[model samples]
Target chain A: MIIIISFFSFILEYLFNYLLKKTLFLPLITLTTTVIVRPFFKKNNNLFYMFCFILGFLYDLIYTGNFFLSAGIYLIIGIIINLISTNMPNNIFTSIFKIICAVIIYRTLCFLFFYINGITIFSISNLFKSIYSSLLLNIIYGTLIYLILYLLSKKFNIKRID
Target chain B: MHKKEKNKRTIIILSSIILSIIIATIFIKKNFNIPSYGIKDGMMYVNNIITRIFGNKDYYKLEKENEKLKEELEQYKDYKSLNEELNNEILKLKETLSIEELISDREYAFGTVINRNFDYWQEKLIINIGKNKEIENNMAVISNGNLIGITDDVSINSSSVILLSNHKFPLNISVKIKIDDNYIYGILNNYNETTGTYEIIGVVDNIDIPQGSKVYTSGLSSTFPSGILIGNVEDVTTDNFDLSKVINVKSETNFDDISYVTVVKKGNK
Candidate 1:
């Protein structure tokens, strides 16, 4: 369980969370620190906010065709995900919601960017195809992510590092 | 007691992040067009190379076409003198032709239909020839004496050819009837999910041509050679309240049965 978690969190790129939003920050950050930098500090504050910058920057690069748009969004998402996760039950359900929101926020933002340019993101005939794909994809992948994280928590005796 | 407060704070942070992403998206749109990257470069070239090195299955189909062509060529060779005389007669009838001297002298490269991709939105096929075999874009694809379609795009080793039946190629087709030499033009297109069926939406008169009328490409344009076989015409009917005839075309080169084809390399280019 632990090995699979570490592998998925780090290696498998292009993990989707919502109908159209694909985010990689949670996996990359969680895996890198959990597998590589866990001993450096028993507790660290900077890790929580950093994911947002990375996520926003990456999204901006791919979606908005600019820099830092995704960085800022991700930075904010990271902070939010971290903060909610800290106070929540931290169960399978919590993780699922986390993923759903992460993807929804990302997709909505991507749509907004296109919407502002007077081009309709949802207006295109193919919008439903994209939306349908996202919905079906999120349920399957989100469940897999939940299981991997659950297994990791048990196997390596790894707690939530953050 | 303190944990509840933290949960509230977390919710607030999440909302703020979403709000900011929304605002930022609008700002970016006002500045630049939607920021999205295109497909990866070099993938097409690599796919072509891979298809070639692996030996395209469509090669079998093209080989079959080649065998048929060879028989036709052999038969023509036997009657070479008659062919020359017949060709001369046809040539004199249309002396002031649209073809330039060099293009008129182009030769057809042989290939085969290797694979077929069909859906409700797009229908496509693959051929065995590629850059390794000297194939290029917009070169007319043909059989013994019929038009198919032009190449979609070319790779170093293989080129993707779009059939005339594809929805992607929308242009006027000028078909001259074999009998009575009656000329009829129509909009010929392939629906997304149908194989071996293309429609002519604008037939002008009731086409009483019986089943199995041979269809040919009218080489009104440089895209196709004159008199290349397109398909067999079926379901010719005229509609009320509409000025044109509806045509159901059953193509001769069904992707299902195609094992060989010729990529007629016009002028060896």
Candidate 2:
């Protein structure tokens, strides 16, 4: 199920990028979907971690030139989200917040990766402009996804594993 | 005791994962020739199908117009005279040098763009032809006779091109501007994000480089052949700190609308 969700999310991302060329913000649907599905498999934490790593590896192989950077970042993020989600209440607002936080963290990591690779965009204003645009779109898209997931869970009566 | 054991196991797992990531990164960096042929082929196949189903109709009309214009330009009588004059000057220089001159033959492979990188900041595009078509790294990629980019990573059926507008490791091209009877040389580097143009730096302050003068690749590097049209000088400003001149170049290629490109493969001279 996680793999299927990630695959579809990747396709959606490709379509969005292909159609909307100039849009600064890109919603990371795959990572967000993985975070949303984590609660359903809380007991099997190792399997979840493995799934995150594999999904991230595949993403890197297809999209990026770097091999392990995405995989490592995703694994760490999955762990962080797993820890937070276990303590926090699973609701629409909190879920949306979590997705926003995840997107910020991912973008920050990407910025750091760019810096390390010596592709530093010198102006702080420019950096913030790109980040804020992307953040705004990610939040909007994330809210919609969260609402859909909330409705589906409620209708299907899916219980949390913990 | 149960909680303590679980915490210990969690810490061990986290540490191991970090260690594995470090090792993997190092390994991949050292052995960089991992050909992602299967993934690229799958992506190209899917993209081709999608584009065919929902392709832009206007691109075809533009391509036809571009071809027509090129044919018309080639038939101009003034262009023939200019070509003859340039060839005569080259022959005179060769005689003066008293050395054997060998012209490197270039092979062009035409390809269609398959995909573009997802990141907005990264200036990269994937083309359909790759190692299968003898396309290798550092080959010059031109669109409609204007320089666009250079091929970087190649798979079996696809190759990724790094554009000149890429902020990362700004591609340094040696360029020159002809002024009356002399040519002034400078290095083109560091794209100006605000102005959306490339700046030619390190030009001597004394040279009178005119606005609207053309910039061509000096062929200092083997990757790109000399005489390829890069851009035109839009504005020139003197650096306040240093006495050098900074010339702003307006690129010839419209990056947004590039559909087809010709990859030039020059034989060893």
Candidate 3:
């Protein structure tokens, strides 16, 4: 199920960024990470971390050109997911909150990394714009992916943590 | 007591891992770029096939329209010939004055934009041609016959281009504003994302320079070839000290709509 989601996310990312050229309208890549958050607690946490490492590594390989930078960033995000969603009950409202937090965390980490490396100039306005520009699209994508996974889990009798 | 201790340990371990990764990011070589060329190109190939099958259904109609436009454009041949004669006269005068710069042959490799990286620094484009097509770093990239960006990282079959609109990098290219029978050179430095224009700084004070003057590469900088159309000046202003002029240019090339690019390399003079 995770692999399928990742594959579709990859294709959709290409569609949005390349064919449609609507990257400003939709951030399907980052929001798709939310799918694995629920499965993290139900399974072995180490395996989940490894999955994120591979996903991030692949992301860097295909897109960013950096080596393990995204891998590490994704690992950190995985930890964040575990930390935030560990105690919260699984519901639509909580899912929205988690998605919002994840987008902020992802953008902040990326901005900080780029700013520190002198790859991007630091500006409070740009940071807020970056965060806000992606928020609406990512929230919709996150909720859709979450609901799809939820339905699939129910149909397949997959064990999910409350 | 035991559960709390376990959670604390887990947090410590995760934090340690994150710290180590951050340290690695700092120490790692910035140019240690290993892009997955085959995988990306393969995906693009598939995408192209899919797009061809499902997209552009009116290809024949567009071709017919293009042919009709070419026929209609034949009436302008006299004007074109007159312009060519004037250009030849200017070249002859320049040669007689011994101020003519050596012009080199330019070779262009056409490629499709496979990816647009809209990540944090959203100014990169991945093209399908790279070292295989003799694409090198700093080679000028253009779309629709207008300057767009320069090649940055070249892999086996793909290369990344850093667009002129990139504000993160202080990549200054020498440019000249073409006025009536005169040219004023300046440095194309900054890009204003909000205004969708480029800021040309270090321009000499020219009070009579009108808006909509054509800007082109000066070829003073070795990175780009001369005479490539950059844009037209939209507005001009003086520095706070009123020493040098700052020109704002609006490029005809739509950065967002870039799908095809031609990478140009200058040959020997």
Model 3 residue runs over 4 Å out of place are: A22-24, A34-37, A40-43, B1-29, B35-43, B46-50, B53-101, B120-122, B168-170, B205-207, B240-243
| Pairs with backbone N, CA or C atoms under 3 Å apart (clashes), candidate 3 | none
Q: Largest DockQ belongs to which candidate?
A: 3
Per-model DockQ against the true two-chain complex: 0.11, 0.29, 0.37
Q: Pick the candidate with the highest TM-score.
A: 3
Candidate 3, residue A122: how far the Cα is off, in Å: 3.3
DockQ, cand. 2: 0.29
User: In candidate 3, what are the lDDT values of residues B105-148, reduced to their tens digit?
Assistant: 36789998777755544467888888889899999999978899
Give per-residue CA lDDT, model 2, range B2-83, as digits (tens). Answer: 7997898688668756764575456444635365568767877667766776677568887999999888987877789997
Highest lDDT against the true fold, candidate = 3
* Candidate 1 CAPRI level: incorrect
Between 2 and 3, whose lDDT is larger?
Answer: 3
Candidate 3 clashes: the total is 0
Q: Per-residue lDDT tens digits of candidate 1, residues A65-146?
A: 3445556556655655665665665565666566666655545554555455433323443333333434444545556666
User: What i-RMS does every model get?
Assistant: 11.4, 3.6, 3.6
Those runs of model 2 whose alpha carbons end farther than 4 Å from true positions after fitting are A136-162, B20-35, B57-105, B112-123, B143-145, B167-171, B180-183, B201-207, B237-245, B254-260, B267-269
Q: Can you tell me which runs of candidate 1 are displaced by over 4 Å?
A: A1-162, B1-106, B111-122, B126-136, B143-147, B180-187, B190-195, B205-207, B240-242, B256-260, B265-269
